[model samples]
Target: EPEVTQTPSHQVTQMGQEVILRCVPISNHLYFYWYRQILGQKVEFLVSFYNNEISEKSEIFDDQFSVERPDGSNFTLKIRSTKLEDSAMYFCASSRDRVDSGNTIYFGEGSWLTVV
Candidate 1:
């Protein structure tokens, strides 16, 4: 089965620094997303992309966060300025279609980000 893959399994950064997390979603999937889970909290949706544009986003996905599909296979999330509260496990996910359509979402192992 196809799966999402993420890079830099873990990263440590200073507050106010910028960091880019990379991902390769299932090749056949058309919808992509980014989610984050702070330690001890539930997973939160950050943003969703389809047809090369953002379909939806949460308030947490403010100006500091951006997503891009620079090439056909690579999707990336850039944090312009990291904050201590930004520390969390960032998950890259994808689905053949929207969840409402009954398609399942697949997630990567996640990139753990730590801000100091």
Candidate 2:
């Protein structure tokens, strides 16, 4: 089965530096999403994209963050300035359906971002 994949399973960065977390979503899926779990907290949605534009975004997706599909398979999230609070497990998910209830979203193992 095709699965989402993320790079640098773990990363450590300075508090103010920029970081780009990479993901390669499933080949045939159309809906893509980014979610983050702050240590023990529940997974929180950041943004969802389809048809090359953002479909929905949560408040957590603030000005410092942006996402792009740099190629047919690769999706990326860039944080312009990292904060301590930014440290979390960022998960990339993809689904066949745009609606959540219609299909199951598959998640990557997650890229653990650590800012100090």
Off by over 4 Å in 1: none
**lDDT per residue, candidate 1, 21-59, as tens digits?**
999999999999999999999999999999999999999
Give the alpha carbon lDDT tens digit for every residue of 14-71 in model 2: 9999999999999999999999999999999999999998999999999999999988
Q: What clash count goes with each model?
A: 0, 0
Query: What's the lDDT for candidate 2?
Result: 0.94
Find the 10 residues in a row with the least total lDDT in model 2: 95-104
Which residue pairs show collisions in model 2?
Answer: none
Each model's RMSD to truth, in Å?
A: 0.8, 0.9
lDDT per model, in order?
0.96, 0.94
Q: Which residue pairs show collisions in model 1? A: none
